[model samples]
Target: MKNSSFIRKDIFGVPVLKSEILESFKDLSHGFSTRRGGESPAPYDSLNIGIAVGDLEENVKKNRNLISGISCSERSVYLTQVHGSEILVIKNDSSIPDPDTVKADGVITDCKDLALVIQTADCQAALLYDPVKKVAGAVHSGWRGNVFDILGRTVRKMAEVFDSDPSDIRASIGPSLGPCCAEFINFRTELPEALWAYGDEKCFFDFWEISRAQLQKAGLQADRISVSGLCTKCDKDSFFSYRGSKITGRMAGFICINN
Candidate 1:
């Protein structure tokens, strides 16, 4: 029901956030990375997992490798996230290309040991796992994605592709721009009318609740979804925050089925 559902843990000197909601499933490997423990320098600081953010490609690769190693995934699929609702579904692990090749804001997969990575500086990464169908998905639901209902679309995609029931899906929203720091001055022009209700008079919006409501609307149970509620802008030292620092690195959210 709150961020208390997630815990911070150290993995090979790197700090990551793990949710208790998905911990009961031994066949699943999932975590949200902090901005610590990597090869990038300065603005990226250390654990910046996004290669398109001006960081050196070698540094990003090494950082991603560290994430893959700690996550126990064979390969981590990074995407060219454009903040849209396009969700890519992976059914095969063979012939996988290098990172940041795919163009999608979300990814669903039945392939084991292949981690779906959603890199974010302040956006929300919703991780989904349908243990019943052995399916896993990751969605980068930024403000634009919320307007498009990316998570809901991903859920329906899973149902269509993997025959996964939303009831059987367990979802988690990782650390992101919380309501406290998510101030949008032009909500009327930027956000949809329905989404306007989630904002305050001062313009700050509660995206966590927005994502939770979207998941429930997509047929997922409220109890099965966990929100980290950790604000990236507030905790800029731990996670990257573009709003806090425009020239910042991207932390990632990873999910995979154990081989």
Candidate 2:
């Protein structure tokens, strides 16, 4: 299923997953990183792109640099994702700041060569690109993000800031916790009533469908949206799953307008 929408490639020894939908655009460069081939040791084994996940800052920095190199990004913005509705809009190089100080779950930019990066272990990293407006966005949408509708907010942000029409945007939902492994036993107390309907008889929720619904609600065309259908928790050898291992490393999903 992953091969249908994505391609696996080795970049500087790191395994990166690319979306064929995004790859069709010659002006963009994007990929999702796997958890192998980096400088970090166990728990983080290698390629842990997250700095706040208790990994050594130096190792994380190297891993980040490696991913940037793999993506051909002149500059990469790694947000301190809070699973909130806030979406940072970058219109020019002047608007760029130290991303370490910026806290947001999603980021959009029209500037070329500036890669929008979202680090995740099991959360969905939704990458959106509007060829009409030449704008790109990356959002970190976990369960809390779903509650806040962060993806919808991101699409709105792109529209309000970059004049991007949701219909003209092509979006892709990357590898995350699939419904088969996403069991929420406490759904009665944790999730909202509306969200409970998306769960199965066993309390397993389909977050991928939830993301698609949110995107459609934001006015995106159904045909333009792509889902990787790769489950992180099920395929532990290829991805990092927070639910599977509490002390595991994090993978990265990146998108950039080529310079």
Clashes of 1: 0
Task: Write candidate 2's Cα lDDT for 181-200 as tens digits.
Answer: 99999988878898988999
What C-alpha lDDT, on a 0 to 100 scale, does residue 82 get in candidate 2?
85
Candidate 1, position 96, lDDT: 60
At residue 107, candidate 1 shows an lDDT of 89
Worst 10 residues of 2 by lDDT: 1-10
Against the reference, the lDDT scores of all candidates come to: 0.90, 0.90
Clashes of each: 0, 0
TM-score list, all predictions: 0.96, 0.96
lDDT of 1 at 138: 95
In order, what is each prediction's RMSD in angstroms? 1.8, 1.2
